[model samples]
Target: MNLSFFDQFASPSLMGIPLIIIAMMFPALLLIHQDNRWITNRLSTIQSWLLHMITKQLMIPLNKKGHKWSLILMSLMMLLLTINLLGLLPYTFTPTTQLSMNMALALPLWMATLLTGLRNQPSISLGHLLPEGTPTPLIPALILIETTSLLIRPLALGVRLTANLTAGHLLIQLISTATIALLPIMPTVSILTSLILLLLTMLEIAVAMIQAYVFVLLLSLYLQENI
Candidate 1:
């Protein structure tokens, strides 16, 4: 029984083949594709509007150079948003909950931004390692600290998404289990727990959306600095 809770996170397999790839691709397959129509349906219109809003918000802090990333970042945000929300469904696995997957998504993008900075403006980029006004004695220490912080960015990005989704899933599972266990013996408490579970599910939905935005937003910010 103890192991069963964690089993939900394990990748499901068919025969001997793992289905994780399918799960990862499932969300993208749900998106509506345009068929050369100038006028779109209501669903497609809403999707387009939301995409426009998100793109506008993300690009506001960035310069023209950074605007080149609009398509990539928007697609990433949509992918993450869809996957995160899909994970909340019954019997579905969330790839974002895996540290490896999140890191894979984070590291490449983070490295790209860092590389862009280093290649385009090496002096300015390296200058960020040590503040201009620092005293001579503290220069070495401050550089080390800042360097460490810089290296930790991708790690933090991965762990943040993993931890938040994992905790919320675990909490939902625990509360759901308690509600089920109490249904027969304590009807009143069971109902109360169910109500709380409902509220938590709603909150988790919001978290799913916000975390996706935050992940992309931070990437845009990093790009902003580099550009």
Candidate 2:
């Protein structure tokens, strides 16, 4: 009875008011706890462990200059990871599914990385636009092309996250609809389809975790190069 499959991606609201504020606030669920004790709860322990492992991995390639970003990068990862997983639940709204939200997440950090590079190493950063030993004939073209590619990175990041989550959600909705529709006419087929849906849901969970990691990982790499 919905108007469209795309309706789920719409900014869920009540009585003409948008729920983006609530959606943004939902990541607080990942806070786990704020206890300050000798022994931590298991949930807090797991959260700390995950953050430590990810930070260690990302810091391996980065020098001390880039190490300052560990907390910021990890926070973004946890926020995206929590939101993506929460959205998989029935009747949940996913702000990350929107290009604007993803772009907002991507742009400032990307700009930070770019600005850091430009500020710390102007010659090297500008040098990236043109490789060494370029012939004079292609100098203009190469710089223009590389500059275009550089500017497009944030757009690519935003689109990639949005498209992956949106596609997965759409597929889940379509299959779920089919499963319900088949229940009355074809119970056996419906059961099989539901099994497939279960597997797909598991895959989506993995995808959610991965996309979050990749988003942060790429940013770390960006910061690594600049620092």
Candidate 3:
């Protein structure tokens, strides 16, 4: 019974083919392509407006060179947001809940920014390891500490997304189970629990959106530093 709660996190497969890939691709399919028409439908208009707002907010802190990444960042944000919200649906799997998937997304982008810094301005990038006027005794220790912190950024990114979604899912499941179990013995308490569950579901929806935005926002901040 205890292990059943964790089973939800496992990647679903059929005939030895993982369906997580399909889940990841599903969001992109929902995006509508714009035509040459002068006017568009309400759905398309709303999509365009949201994308515009997100892109504008993300690009505010970035320099002109960083703006080149607007498309990639916006697409990533939408993908994550869709996956998170989709996971809340009944019987749907969330790819972002897996640490491996999150790390795969994080490491490449993090490495890209790091590599960009190294390629464009090697001196400035290396200078980030140490500050000016540091005592000789603390140099080695500070470099070690900074290097460790630098290496942990991608790991932190992956863990943060995975942990938040996983915890929310677990809490929802637990509360739902309690509500069901109490319905037979304590009708009043069960209804109250159900109401609480409803509120938690709404909060989870907000968390789903916020976490996606945060993941992208941090990447943009990292890019800002390197660029």
Per-model C-alpha lDDT, please? 0.94, 0.91, 0.95
Per-prediction backbone clash count: 0, 0, 0
Lowest lDDT block of 10, candidate 3:
24-33
Q: What's model 1's overall lDDT?
A: 0.94
Model 3 TM-score? 0.97
Q: Specify the highest-lDDT model's number.
A: 3
- The local lDDT score (0 to 100) that residue 9 gets in candidate 3 is 96
> Cα lDDT of model 3 overall?
0.95
Q: What ordering of candidates by lDDT runs from best to worst?
A: 3, 1, 2
Tens-digit lDDT string for candidate 2 (106-216): 999999999999999989888889999999999999999999999999998999999999999998999999999999999999999999999999999999999999999
Clashing pairs in 3: none
> What C-alpha RMSD separates each model from the true structure?
0.9, 1.4, 1.0
Q: Model 2, 89: alpha-carbon shift in Å?
A: 0.4
Residues 68-130, model 3: lDDT tens digits: 999999989999999999999999999999999999999999999999989998899888999
Candidate 1 residue 24 Cα shift, in angstroms, is 1.1
For model 1 the local lDDT of residue 64 reads 94
Candidate 2 structure lDDT: 0.91
Residue 51's lDDT in candidate 2: 79
lDDT of 1 by residue, 183-203 (tens): 999999999999999999999
